[model samples]
Target: MRSSSRLKRAALPRSAPATSAGGSKTDGNHGLIAGTAAKRRTKKEADDAQGPSKPAPKKRRKVIPVKEPEPAASGSEASTQTSHADTKQPEQHLPSLPLDVLYEIFSVLDPHGLIQLTHTCKYLCTVLASRKLDWAWKVARKNSPGLETWDPPKDMSEMRWASLVADTSCSNCGAGGVTSVDFRLRMHLCEQCSKDGLIHSSRLAKAYPDLLPIVRELVPYTNKKLHSNKKSDKYFWIDDLQSMDKKIRKLQAEDPSAVDDFCKERRDLVKSILGRASYLRQWHARYMESRVDFRMDQIAGRFQAIGYQFEDLDNPKFYLHPLVRLDTPLTDAEFAEMREVLQPVLAQIKQQRTKAERSSKVLELYDQYKKTLLPIQRIYVPDDGNFLWKYPKFSALLTRDTSLEITDAEWAEATDALPTYLSRFIEAKRDKHIALMHDRYPAPDAMEFITLAASPQALQHAREETMPHFAGPLELAIATFTHREDTVVRYNRLFTGRELCNSWFEKVKFQFADRESGLVAQMVRMAGLNPRSTTATEMDDLGAQFFCRTCHNTDHERAKAAQEPHTLWACSWRGLLDHFRGSHPTAIKIGLVNHEFYTLERTHNVIDIFENWCCNHCSEEAVAFLPRQAADDHLQAAHGVLTPSVGRDVFFRPPALNVMAPHGIQSYYQFKDSIPPQASLSTKEPSPTS
Candidate 1:
């Protein structure tokens, strides 16, 4: 059975797809186990007992054919009615499977396995294909348990809802590994089915005006596009298509006078549950992200206990393990058991890795003979390339291999070739990484691009992500993570990191350059602030799209009240960047980058950058703007040096307006209550600007 199961899994991806319980083919969707989508389930999760790691189907371009009416030859109405009665059953085999017993057995089977069972014969297929049999799958889903939450649409039938949990295939088409379910549409389909089968409710309404009233009464306008300028999309709920069709048909049976009342009641019910499913879906998504973050921190702590130090806890290695992602959270004893299971595999990998390193070094010397000495010295050997490591003439450097021992004459020749190889190898490697251009250096703004690039989420970035909507710090984290460029020089200093990729090397070249259009667009559309302070160009020239928009009109601000906040956006990315640098001070630092790297709020001339500068010795702005030497002297004389600064410009922009911290820099979680209280430092002394 174990071998059979292995064969089934191995053959699943390449072979013809298995059919669904309703006798539909689920194909072209079987590949790649769910990675992050796998979560820490508990022991109670029966659906995950066999550990399929139930992957979402691989996205591809298979078409979704329109569903046709049920065939008369598919099943007999007489058998369906009389099978539940005392005389006879519709099933030819499995005579003892009372409906309840059948459900009990099927409850343990996932959708994929249950579908396969139904395909055994036409009798088994007909027996399982009726509406009454839907309860069996429903019971199966309810009995199943896991970290994943499946909330079916309000109008969907029980069997359809159960299919999402019991099987990993499309009921309509038999697409395998179909984890991406849409409750609003009432189906778990592969990507193409989603695009092809489901039409927007608005589009449907326009096409069929006669049925428009019924569709509008049941469906709602929702799921806004990520773009702020686009209209809200409409969707018709079709999870329980039979039930929806039944309801629509019942109106035809009603008295003409009573039909209006029935329609009104239906509309009211839909409105009551209108966004309920959407709300739950959104909540689940947010919960999953936070849970992944929490689990990663726990893993980092566990590694720290075993002697690994991780300065950046958010690093991908901590959170992305295959077993960690797929398995349920184990109790202490279970974790110990799992650890024992993995120890041998880990040891073998480590041993092979060590030998491979030694083997590579040995091969490098032979490679150098071909690359360097062969052209000049005409070095020759009897064996083929890679002979040195494959058929060693001397003992393996890292292992005991008696056969590798050679004669004294061979040793002498080997020694002659090795001396010059080391220097040349080191030089070659250094040359690859050291040479960098001016455009390759990174500045602060590149963090967002870096984070998205480094993350697993980067795979869908172009299709799904909209960078203009991200907050400053989140964007910076992404950029810092993914960008890898070798930068030799910057404004005045130099960039040391070779983290930014080459493609971005070109983009960052003109990123903060004077009056770049891309930067202007980001400032106006993304950061929600104007760059008027830095750029001389107006919003119109950069294209009015580079400003805050309401209904696609970026011509001017949407009219409101004077007391209300501004809706208009600015045109200069650098202008807003400079404005943040000047007015908000540590906002971009606290918001975009960590505070450990920032020294102080850079002053313009001889003035306090932000108004909140308070001193331990003097509770005024006078000490805040003074040169470092003067601040130390005031603290030493007035405050008795009890509170001393290194005279290394570490002063902060203390909060005003009876606040906890500065407004934009509120994310500085490390510094709460650490700021000094207001006091007098110097007696209004004069100081020179540095």
Candidate 2:
């Protein structure tokens, strides 16, 4: 409110004390009264009594008989006093503080106190509601940490207190309940004492899982308000077990058979998806190795070198890689004829020095031959699939094949047709390859691979390059894929367990009478099934030790090398070795996996033939541009040469198995949240809401 308005309100008159007429006290013992007198009786009192009677008779003319009092005027002081006396006291009241004092009080309050005070009193609530008050609190939180934190050192007192106060209200009867809800005051409240205890704890745990870790840390260290004895370790353990038992009972009561059925369904789906995931990875890997380099070249050439200039000063000429007018040479016969015709115009061309004049002269002479044919250079790879398999049955099958064969047409019927068809087909194939790669590409064990891979420049010094040995199988596997690069490997299950222990295995190595399982095998089993330590150091040590005993011992050079080469360093080696060790020889490094795009497109083709025996449109499209059967036939008919097929298998495909399936999702949207909060209703539904 404005200062003027406040001043006017402060000037308001207060109630006056009640009084009788003539300024005397009123009746009910609240006003003045006259005293009664008796006559004197004595010998000398005859004269004295006569004198007293005479004195009384002389004053009997009455006090009010003098000048009459004037009537009070409406605007006079007397009238104002009378009006004020009639007014009653106000019922509402306010603190006896100046505005500045109130502001100071508001400034001292923390966020929690402000929110509470805002709800408690009308005046305080108004002050808190003001935007200015909000700005003040924001500044305070930013500037004054101590004021904000009630007990900062002790369990992050601000948050702990806020959490306690907020959750203290009883959920059933609310705050009005006989038992005030302050569960945090005690470590665990007995449900027997209050039936709502279990329900409250469950709700609290569900609502505040993020805060649970901090609470769990603090709860064990401090004494609860009411549960000093019950807060011991034994009681806490019993409470936890009891809570788990209660939860189990509740779940069983809700739907025992349904839960079992759901678990079974989940297991089966996981198995199916896991199976598909393997095929997808194998196909993706082959595809990537085939086309990764080509794709990288295109990425580097087109995108990386878009805006650059190169000048050859030594040649003393300005050479432009003309976008429109590329250089072409005329044959001797054509040149002779052109020269003969241009001889007459040469003088005129020279005489005309201005650009416009020369241009006009040249245009007039070449009017009839304005159109020029710039020979369209072949940029795409040549397709030789049909020629390679030209047998009648093979041709028929290959003609239908979209994987290796780019097109079915023997020749282009129109000029535009070739470019359009090639563009569309390449695009379609690239897309297919990319999808296949994503599906097939296995997630690499980056940590392990980086740890193992040969350091840069070390490959040159090494006597034996492991990558080269594997490179052939790896590249062949890569080349096997026509589209998706990642579609090259399949694993039944991802092994996550302990690693082989070098010390234990080494100790058991030459004991003649000792009866222990193969140390390597035992170590592998232990690492796979149960690890001794959770630290990264332990896993790495175990992995390195195992590698030394098995893969490293064969080559002295490899053993001597401080850092392993590309193949040994790869993360896949760790994952695969670990995988094999887990389930004996059931799973091993059957194929390589990669994540690049183009490689996957090529690999997709390989996987289509090798694993799924299906066509991927994306890889097919990419291969179309590179040179397909039709293009190869064109080359035979036109250039009579074919490009190699080694580069055709690189394409990346997306994983086929859904990563979110285990979480009860058919598509990405089903799990809007990390975990589904809503229970499935088709199994069972709550009774219809009346």
Candidate 3:
């Protein structure tokens, strides 16, 4: 409010307060004359208050009442005989504070606070509530952090801006639960007011059928508010309809287009408005979200910097509200103070977690050592009773009771240092197994072959590397080796008890130990089953069922170096070993199983016909050997001719088996000197060697 207007607030008449000359209760021409005089006086006072624009101090003003009260009878000339009681009639209520004091107070207060202060008193409310006091509100809006950022709309008065920011009471119901102002409706409303009092634009059109198009043209069908049908539905504020009705009538009176060409103009206007409203809605949404997101980020970041997980902590209603004003979340002094207090507490939690994790590590290592390693040591190596106790650290690890907690340092000393000792023991056990195998089959590379047989990746790797011709028979063995669905049945019913540790050589001999099909008969049977070629005859070695022609898999360099026949057919696992050995040479060298993607797309035509009994030129038998290159070399080097059968692999027919029935899968004579296959689904013990 202007300084001169404020002066009137401090001295307004009790019954005849000065008002606009154009107000409803104006006293005609006389009131207009008085209003003009008052206007002139106000201008003079304003000029005097703001004589210099360069930041000068405001001088205190002594207000003079517009009209003076008549002198009372008890004045200095009162009768001496007048009683003391008559002289002191009731005192008038203390007059409001001087306008200068009110102005100074409003200058320092926030815009919201200034509006609230006006409501507690009558005179101050009238002066501050006037739309003419826009300059006062402009000063007020700058007092608060969030309010200063808002650029008031051109058509909005400072009074409306103040109301939108400071009014907490719902405009529709006077309920004090308003969260924010509805800019479209130009009112502040509570949640219930927003939900129940807001109607879809269709509802407005339905209610006013004759003016539907005009309503659509004027009213914005904003869908900014989210609800169940937010995507396709548009809403209109119900409380705005009355004002809209008045506005429409006013438009009809002033705009000739509304009457001259109603339908088409209204339709065009509606289309234009909808387009503008869509762009405005998008801009408004981005603006609103950016503001809320910025404050939320600040609050979250500040809390997290002090190690507070705000979302993890249940949101408490009392603490969350009031911190945010009109969607601007303010992290005030209290939150900063709370952060300082939490930092030390967060440090304590870190220390405690470190200790707990150390304890968990101790427990986990102890359990793993007990379940897998201890069972094997107890059952197989009986002579090594209490052997672990020989080492002080190992002894300590074994004796520690589960109920007792171990320090991180002590656990690391015992568990970390014991692996080397345990590895030595495992090596000794493997040597014993190797010795037993040598006693039966006697091979220089028996140990390497046994290690490959025990690998976990022996099936899938084998399948991927097999030549397309032999993929069928080899895959049959691979299927049995994996046995995904019936593994328990295969392992327990067939491969258990004393038979689990059988030698590879013994197992191979047992495949033919069925005592039915003779050794030669079994080879013909498996050769017939081989998919590489229908041509079946005799294979040079046991490995004819699966080995790749060019690259041999497994760490079987020892066996190959010794020229051990690439034989021993059990499971298609040879293919997996071939791929592993060729592609993951480092893993094979280190005796490690690599999980990396590896391949072995080697050509094998020469190896397929190395020993098949057919004319080398074009027998299905030649394709079955996988030795296309080797066979070509055999033809070229030894016979001085290139074999037509080098690259092309074609299976013609299976040779008749010696037995009427297919030879037993375990025909022994053919594999007596070789390592046994571990990829079979069946794990029967080898028949007593005879």
Candidate with the greatest TM-score versus the true structure: 3
- Residues 1-690, model 1: lDDT tens digits: 001111122211211112345635322211111211242233326555646786534644333343453444435885555445423333333543344465577767644345566656444444455444555555544543432355445544444444433445654556675544443443445554444444456565454444535645654433432222444565443333224445666766765577677778767756655546566556545544554455455555664577543433333332455544422223466556645654454444445555665566566555544343211011112112333432333234536432243445664565454434333332332233323221232222221222112343542341133222111121221121112233422111111111122122122331222222223334443323343221212221232212112211222123223333222222222233334433443323111212332223322222223443323323243655454456656767775664443211123232211111111211111211332111100112111110
TM-score of 1: 0.31
lDDT scores of the candidates, listed in order: 0.37, 0.29, 0.41
Candidate 2 residue spans exceeding 4 A from truth: 1-101, 108-120, 129-132, 136-690
Q: What TM-scores do the predictions have?
A: 0.31, 0.13, 0.39
Q: Go through the candidates in order and give the C-alpha RMSD of each one to the true structure.
A: 28.3, 38.6, 19.3
Model 3 C-alpha lDDT per residue in residues 1-690, reported as the tens digit of each score: 001111112211211222344655432233434564797698778878886775544665544344443455765544444445344322111132454465677777666566566555554555665544556788877765555766565445665666655556566655665545555445555565566756677565566555435455455454645344574677665434455556667767799576546545545644665555445445555555555555555765776675655542223331243343234434478567655664454445544444445445555664445333311121222222244555677556445653366666886787765445555553454344334221132222211111112343532232223222221221122111111223332221111111212222122221211111122233334344442222221232233333222233342355567877433222122332333333443333111111121122223332243342222232122333343355456456544555333112221111221111111121111223332423111133221111
lDDT winner between 2 and 3, please give it. 3
Clash tally, candidates in order: 35, 99, 31
lDDT of 3 at 33: 41
The candidate with the higher TM-score, 1 or 2, is 1
* lDDT of predicted model 1: 0.37
What TM-score would you give candidate 2 relative to the actual structure?
Answer: 0.13
